[model samples]
Target chain A: MEVLGIILAGVLVNNFVFMQYLGICPFLGVSKDFDMATGMSGAVIFVITVASTVTAALEQYVLKPLELEYLRTIVYILVIASFVQLVEIFMKKTLPGLYQALGIYLPLITTNCAVLGAAMLNVTKSYGVVLSTVSGFAGALGWSLAIIIFAGIRERWKLMDIPATLDGFPLALISTGLMSLAFLGFSGLFSNLVK
Target chain B: MGDRLLVTPSPHVKSTKTVQGIMLDVVIALCPAAIAGTVLFGFRSALIILVSVASAVASEALYQKAVKRQVSINDFSAVITGLLLALTLPPHVPLWIPAIGAAFAIVLVKQVFGGLGNNFLNPALAARAFLLAAWPLHMTQDWVNPMTYDAATSATPLAGFNATGQTAFTLKQMLLGQRPGSIGETCILALLLGGLYLIVRDIIDYRIPLGYLGTLAIGTWIFGKPGAFFQGDPLGAIFLGGAFIGAFFMATDYVTSPVTPRGRLYMGIGCGLITLVIRLWGGYPEGVTYAILFMNLVTPLIDKYVVPRYYGSGHDKMARKGGR
Candidate 1:
């Protein structure tokens, strides 16, 4: 039940893109098409999930015992970077099909704030390893859901007669605003349901 | 005489109205509210309006000149944007506030995207939202007492009504614009005249205003009172705040609103529903600007689904048969 609540909270109530305003770069950049958005989302889900588990374990075993908690930011970022590099190599060696699917976006995910944010947030919330993994996977899933829906909307948006000045980023930003407004409905969902 | 017909290309239909003509009509319509706002408040109100309009026009011209594009300053669109932004500001805001708002509207919101016909959101309202976020205290606490022009910090009718479920002003004062609120939003008669003139001159469609105001009235009447249901002051809800101006001017913007008639009606109703929700239950005392801007974002979707039946498609019959 707790895991269910965390997943629900992560996917809907605390969506990384529309709700928390995280990972906006890729949210806007790769959201113009559907297939690319899917690939990007898949890569993110794997990396964030792995990165969260490792960072949580490291904080529990290393930082807490040494009382070097303040260095957690630097440690977590370094772990995430190295972990993504390892994933890239492993995917290329054994799972080349999946590696090519993610292509350039795999490298881009290293800098994505959502990944770093998930790692840091797991530590901040002091989640156990199990909850950390669940929250990270759920956060990435929430991002996938948002990007997919936005991609569908933009696909249809292409045919509409948009004004010249609003053809690109301006229109995209307004669309994000409306999407955020819709996501605002999810606020307090977990709290209301838990009671 | 040789009787040869002139076979022109597509778009054979032509109209006498130009973009400048439409924008000029809007400017003329806004005159009554501008005059009334200045009269009710002091010279500061007039100065704010002038600075706002001038900055908007100047920004557009300067941006175009800098970018080496043909300057379209002759069209009064920037002036209209400036006027709309000024009307939404508090009467006592510093002169720089409107100037900054105008520059943001014209340069960033409108010109950056392309220009007049290209902006996705209502430039004036977006800039107002930006200003509100940047300086909430100045925007909310700078309301001057009407007529006296005293630097009063009294809450507006909507604010008081939302907080205590009551208001000090009566129906007559509300109608006659004797309240402390945004400069142009206070006067119903002036805004009505401008809105009516636009409708009469065929500058704007009537369905948007009617649908927006009607939905707001119904929604507020149904759920306005805090605890008691169906016991809310619908009239006061409609008259107070920026609803009157928003419904008529900002929401009816040509570039941001839907092109089809029915789609525009839906836009209006959607805006009204959002506005009521925000006003009655949300944290804000007013929701006109955000409501309209939100609906503006949805305009494209409305246009997509609410398309008029093609002239001779007859696909409706096949679709019905397939459904069965």
Candidate 2:
């Protein structure tokens, strides 16, 4: 039941992109096209999941023992960046088809704040390794859900006769604001079981 | 010969109907509800409506002038948005609530997306949701008893229903707008007349309303009771809240709903499902506002996948992928 709460909170009730305002860069950058957005979603899900598990393990095994809790952010960045590299190489050799679909987005995820944010959040929330992995995957799913829906809407901009200045990010950000306003309906709609 | 085959710009279907004419028809249809709301709630309701519509028109004009775009306030869509937003608010709110809401609707929701036809979300519904979030007490607690004109508490039928799963108001009272709710929401007869007017004039698709109400009725019947099934009052459920107004006016807006018939049906059903979930289990007493807004955002995706099969289209899967 508690696990269900975490998953539900991550995906809908407390979505990272819409609710927490994380990963706005890639969310706005690669969301102009639907397929590209999905590719980015796939990359985010993989990286955030792996990064969450590794960070949780490091927090438990290394940080607490050495009293280096303050170095956690720096250490998580290093872990995420190197893991993205390792995945890029390993996928190129073994899963070349996926590499073709997700390769262009993997490097972009190396510096993504959502992955790092997910790791830092796990530390603060005191989530163990397994729950942290689930939360990471769910948060990425929620982010992916938002961007895909946004990309679906943005694709229609081709059909519309928009203004000169409000063509790209200006319109995108406005739409995001309205969308988050609507998503606010979900905030107190359910119990805060995750906490 | 030249007269018979004139070379006019394309859109050659012969019709006197226009955007302006359709919007005028909507305002006309909304009159009965607006009047009933004013009569039931007193002059305060009328002032709110006027302020909302005026501010909405002003916002559109001012924004267009500031941005050097064509001022399209004469088209009357802003009036309709303002009327709808004001209608959904609790009666006797501060006049500025509707004013601010109207501006938010016109400027942020409608104009930012390049004006009336281009916006995907319903402007009025979005504004109402904004107001509800920004000022929960006024939006929820400002309701008054229909005739006595006093601030109502447990007298609000929807809240009573939400708390006890049972209603003290009779069906006739609920139907006659004798109870307390949002300004336009209390008078079922007036809203129905407006909806019938829209349907008769072909301003809205009938299937959208039918699907929305039908799904809500069935869901209410199936899950309305605490432990029993198929024991809920579908008629009371439809008449108690914004379901009537939402189904007829807001949910069926052509700009935000699907272009295809099948997609509109799905949109209505999706709205009904979400409304049921919220009313039954979620925190809010009414779910129509959020239900409609959520479907409005999903509408583009529905339009994408529910594309009508064109003539001579290939059956090949890869062909379809390449076509999109």
Candidate 3:
């Protein structure tokens, strides 16, 4: 039940992309096509889940005991960056198909705020290691959900008769606004279930 | 008359309507509300509208000339945008507010994005949102009394209702535009006349207005007042704030709204739901502009998913599965 609450909170109630406005670069950049969006989402989910578990363990055992909390940001980024690198090399060796599908996005996950944000959020919220790990996986899934759905909707505009000026980024931003509005419906969803 | 054989592509049957004609009708439709606003708020309101309109037209022409694009001011779309921007403003804001807002609307929101037909968000509402964010005090707390035209810091009816579950004005006064609010949004009757003219002329789709008002009325009736669900006043919710103008004018904008009939209906409902959510629970007293703007963003999504069935593309599984 607690894990369920954590997942719900991370995905719907506290969405990293639409609500927290994190990882917007990848969300917008890779979202123009459906396959790319799914590939990016899969890579983010893998990295985020692993990075969250490792960061939780480090914070609990190393940083907390040493009282080196001020080094949180740098440590978190270093941890997430190394984690993404490991995933990239591992995926290239073992899962060549996915590696090719994700292309540069797998490496770009190091700079994604959502990964670091998940780790930092674990510290700020003082969540336990298990819950923090749960949150990381959920947040990445939430982001994937948004990007995939957005990509599918974007394909519909391929043959649309649009105005000359609203062709690209402007239209995308507006579409994002509406998606965010739809997400707003979930604002109080976890209030009853989660503390 | 010398006869010349002409070879033209599709759309060989052309209507008498042009961009200029449609925009002129919009301007004419807006006159009742504009005139009412001026009569109710004194000459300062009129001056502000003029300044906003002038700034919008000048900005468009200047930007086009600067960018070496053909100056399309003859289409009258800029005039309508300027007029719409002016209507949404508070009557007592400094002249420079409208001027700056008009410039931002034209240059940033409309022209930079491509031009009149291309802007994703409604230029006037986008500018209004910008002004609101930039000058919250001027936007929210600067309402003048309707007839007296004095600078009174009284809360609008929506604000008061949000706080106390009751408003100072009766239904008649709310409908008649005898209230302290934005210049053009106060008068429900004027807005309705304008809306009716557009609908009758077939210039605007009726589904959007119907869907928006119907959803809003139902939502408010169910959950308008805080604690007293289903006992809430629906009429007041529809009449007050910018709901009337937003539903009729802003949400019904062709470029910003969905092209298909079903998509348009969904847009209306979406706007209504968001507006109700904001008015009832969100921090803002008015939600019309943001609601419409948000719906404008969703227009493409709506158009995609709610695609009308192609004629005679009957029982084709591949066609049905294509959206996935």
RMSD of each predicted structure: 7.1, 4.8, 6.2
Worst window of 10 by summed lDDT in candidate 1 chain A: A186-195
lDDT string for model 2 (B10-55, tens) is 3355756677888899999999999999989988999999999999
Looking at model 1, residue A4 earns an lDDT score of 88
Model 2 DockQ vs. reference = 0.69
Cα error of candidate 3 at position A129, Å: 4.2
Candidate 3 chain B, poorest ten consecutive residues by summed lDDT:
B1-10
Listed in order, the DockQ scores are 0.16, 0.69, 0.21
The segments of candidate 1 whose C-alpha lies over 4 angstroms from its true place after superposition are A1-21, A34-111, A122-195, B1-14, B313-315, B318-324
Over the stretch A119-145, how does candidate 3's per-residue lDDT look in tens digits? 888888887788888888998988887
What's model 2's interface RMSD, roughly to a tenth of an angstrom?
1.2
lDDT of 1 at B225: 74
As a whole number from 0 to 100, the lDDT of residue B83 in candidate 1 is: 96
Instruction: State candidate 1's DockQ.
Output: 0.16
What value does the lDDT take at residue A89 in candidate 3? 88
- The better-scoring model by lDDT among 1 and 2 is 2
- Which pairs clash in the backbone of model 1? A165-B113, A165-B114
How is the predicted docking of candidate 3 categorized under the CAPRI scheme?
A: incorrect
Relative to the unseen true structure, what is the Cα RMSD of model 1? 7.1
Give the TM-score ranking, best first: 2, 3, 1
